[model samples]
Target: MTAVTAPEPAEQAKEGEGSLRSSAMRGGIYLVVRQGLNVFLKLIGVMLITRVLGPTEYGAYVAAFNVYLYSTLIGQAGVGVYLLRHPGEVPDLAVRTCYALLALLGIGLMLGLEASRGLLTGWTGVPGYGPVMAVMALALPFKLITIPPTIALERALNYKRVATIEIGGDTAYYFVAVPLALTGTGAMSLAVSLVLRELLFFVLAHYYVGHGPRFGFDGRTAKSVIRYAGTFSFANWVWQARMLVNPLIVGPVAGQHAVGIVGMTVGILEMLSIIKTIAWRLSVSVLGRVQSDFEKIRRAVTEGMELQIIAVGSLLLGFAWFGGIAVPLVFGARWAPVMQLYPYVALAYLAIAAFNIHSAVMSVIDRNTDLGLCYVVHILLLGLGTWLGVRHFGMIGYGFGEMLALLAYGLVHWALARRIGSPDYRLAGLWFVAAALGLFWRQLGWWTIPLPFLALATPASVRRIRRILEQIRKPRRAEARA
Candidate 1:
């Protein structure tokens, strides 16, 4: 019998690298497909729910929901990110410590929300806000507990399973909320639907993870996890404060109706920017695997910038072009403010899309302090601008505030460039300018309509498109040869 030879370490590493890239590509495609379905479901659901609830009721829901959302951040504590980006196999002790930390924080947040419900209601001044908040707060622990198992899957690049669990939970929410909203349940319909979604997620996440709660305390493990978690969470907290600005600042200054308008506009933009979400999640996994290679990370960011702007810019332009006619016709004139707010928010999201990979890279390389500083400048600019603008401009002020905050992205660029070299922003910049002009066409007029198309038809853009196609095909060609 001939003796079998084992593969060398270098060969083994090469195979492992190939497997990771293959898994990331497959996961990315699954997530894209999943988001496409989610977009459809959410579009239908938002149309129905917004029509039924209108601005006043929806505004109330938005306010309470924002409060609940901000509270959940406290419970998250960045444990999932730590787990996902851990260099190699995470220790069981670390996982258990994560579980214990999450549980304690989850319970603490739930109780805190319960205790502050009345105060929150009084502050927002939305009728029945306390009750709605009370209901939403119950989901905090369930939401937090689901993170560990969810991270377990993410670490393995099992996005197919993750997508299924998420879609199921989302479907449950719409099915539960739409009927209830049509029956005049008002804001409570959403609150109830949210609770159900979290419960379903908790169940499904654990089931697929194939494990029960395992809690333990290792002093060293706990210390390491908490050390990372603290920095990550603090940066996240500052970043998430942007969401709270709507409820805390706009709601108080311009009434809940304005809050509803801003909220709806933001929700729609988020739906359209679905690719950013998918890319960011995938980047944490993909980049972590290659974190030691600064050149690879830099290339990823450059390519990501070009591709993201192309993907999201078209959607934003389309919406900016047709949303005015569509919104009033489909959802009624009460939502007309959405069009006024759309361009500003769309511009912010566009800029974010181009630079989002920078943030992901920073996180992967453990540059939380730089990220935190960037976030601080962003939120400060946003908060101060919104407070001033809303006090002066009323409903449109939030949009103005978002525009002003776009300046802070310079900080992100600077911080990221300091670490991994600057990404090539030429293609992304061209697309951004083109999309910006198109988005503001209401002000710039019909002459600007052809500018975006012309930009894309340029020689550079055409070559870049061809290059991207080749990159996509190269993998398949390699697989075929193998």
Candidate 2:
């Protein structure tokens, strides 16, 4: 046999990045379909429950759901990111490390919630949420268990399976949730459905992995993973906590009804947030895999942001155009506050779109310290903004505070990303202006002005759509040409 030689460093990096890009593209396509289905299911579920439970009951569910959401982060203890970052460094050891930590956190959360249900209810002022939250807390361990498989699948770019598991969990949640809500389960509907969803995900994920849960100990790996997890992990926690700022501050000051209003308003924002989620989720693993190649990282960040901006700009503008009329019609007149709150939330998302991939880039570039600092700034700004806004202007003021905080967050990170990614600031500016114009038209009831903004954005949106279609057609096109 002839002797073989290693490829040149530059050439090897090029190949690696190409592979990473292709994997991201393919995985992202599947992810889009998955996220779209999940979004549809969540929207339907929220709409059904909102109509059934009304504000007070829905508010209770939201309060508990927020607790459950934050606890999952605590339960995972940044293991998912750790696994993704170091995919090949003794997978079994990492898995066990994650499992051990997650199990401990999950058990602790479940027991704590069970014991403090009454105290929690009194604190949140959402009467029945104590027990509901306690029950929902049981899902945390199972959710933690699913993370290793998830990270494995994601690292392998096996998003087709990931998509299947997601759709299955979403289906389980809605099927269980809607019927329960219709039968007058109140906040328990959400709590029970969450357990069902997580259990289903756990079962399905394990089946797909073709393995039973393994128990082992790895002191060394645990320490290393936790060490790697430190800065970015804390940063992510802070960022997630920022989401809680409004409800936590508003609930105490304005009562559960106001919290419910904030919940409904955030639901609209979550819908607008789909583009950002899709972009971020798909890009992170890809960025991690290609982290050695700065050129690839830069290209990924820039292109990812562009696509996110285009998608978000179009969706948010369209929502702003029709939201005032649609919110009341869809969820009823009681949710009119959501209509007013949605414009500010939409504007916030617009700024976030400008730097959707920045965090992932930061993680890949070993800038976790900066990432942590960024989130520290974010939480402080958002917390202070929320408190002052709610104190002075009520819910609407809260909305303005959220908008300002997010803009500051986005602009700061966007500047940081520019230093690394070197993207087109002009395009980002245009998207921001376009989003602002949409907000202006919505706020002023100048419906005609937004029409022109939409018109201007339409060409870019269509081009993006065409590129996606071309991606889908590439193989067939090659066959035809051949």
Candidate 3:
């Protein structure tokens, strides 16, 4: 959908201020509620699986699944995301071909994983990861079930639909998987439960987005999505490499137990990320609608980034402060060790929040090649750091290396932003301070605390947040008689 150009800068500023704020606030709320549900489900799922199968088996399952997760991203399924930012001639047709290509790519990934099954297991020591990899191979094609549809919906600013699917799908995974683990099925049960969960979600996504993945491939549409997909392929490759860096290094060097610990911390780190992702998706879609209008895109990009840094940083700070004491109290004592590792990995989340502004800027400009280049630099630093870090050091080394890698990722954005002459210290500096403090001290939590100040700042930020809530709550007024 083409966004209507604002009549002038002042008028557009007023219009954008209200519109972007409303959209982000709405999207953030949907995600917050959905994340709350997902976190609940995750706790239940982890508790059941860990307690039932025990840590050793649970560790094996976590290790096996990450292998699949890493490889799938290696497919660089980022084109769909890029499409959301830089939409073109036809949305439906563009999305149609995107799905077709992914199906093909998914097939190739599955086969490649199968071909090296024996070697992969020997490397990971998860034993039977070969078959788990087989199930994971199914993720790409079946993924056609939801990803494209969700992207289209986000481009439409229909995040409520996304909220529904995530909450509902997560519930499905919990209800189904928790029961299976309870039944004494072991690690394989967790894998089967996950695959089944995706299949169920694929079916449900249809109800919200109309017909699901169609068998017929459209050549013209295929050609269209591929151009953007190629860009996505690069952006996603870097992103995936960053994600896989830990698992790749930790598994071989640290051992199965350490892999499990890292994985659990990753889950906790996601507590805040899940919401930011929804914000990122919304911003990409909204930004796409306004890119040609430089003024609008600029305002949208800046405000969106500021809002995200504030929100995400606050959440992370709060979690880092309390997680040390809270994790064991809530999830049981078995989780106590994980709490120690969390405060450090939180740096990655902070860096992501800080650099995310540049990521938004990059996607809007369609300069995805920069992403691939950045990943190359990041990977080299990460590998060297992780090698020595994991060898002579321990989880502390692994987490510290990750913190620096993420810090460097943000610094990359600062460099890019400076080149454009629109460098953002509110985003970069604020996140940097938060990460530094969170890693060393607890004072950063003040930024998110003070419910009264959020209450106060809402008024100056735009309309007060309470007033916005009132608009959402109040019934519509009836028209006066003509």
Best by TM-score: 1
lDDT of 2 at 350: 74
Badly placed stretches (over 4 Å) of model 1 are 1-12, 16-18
Q: Write one digit per residue (lDDT tens) for candidate 3, span 168-258.
A: 7778777777788888777777777777777766776666767657444667666656676677677767666665655567767887667
Which window of 10 residues has the lowest lDDT sum in candidate 1?
1-10
- Model 2, CA-based lDDT: 0.73
Residue pairs with colliding backbones in model 2 are none
Write the residue-wise lDDT of candidate 2 on 1-482 in tens digits.
Answer: 01111234465467664454565677888988888888788778888888888888888888888877876776677777777766444356557767777777788887776787777677766776786887888888888888877776776678899999989998999999999999988889889999999999998877777775665668987788678768767777877886566447777777788788888877777776787887777767666656777776776666666667667777777777777788778787788787777777677777777777887788767677677777777777777887888888887776767665774565455555565756556555655676666666755667545543564457765675577577547645544675
**Model 1, span 43-63: residue lDDT tens:** 889889999999989998898
Best candidate, lDDT? 1
Clashing pairs in 3: none
RMSD after CA superposition, every candidate: 4.0, 4.6, 5.5
| Stretches of candidate 3 exceeding 4 Å from the true structure | 1-24, 86-93, 217-220, 293-302, 426-431, 442-482
Question: In what order do the candidates fall by lDDT, top score first?
Answer: 1, 2, 3
Error of 1 at 263 (Å): 0.4
| TM-score: model 3 vs. ground truth | 0.82
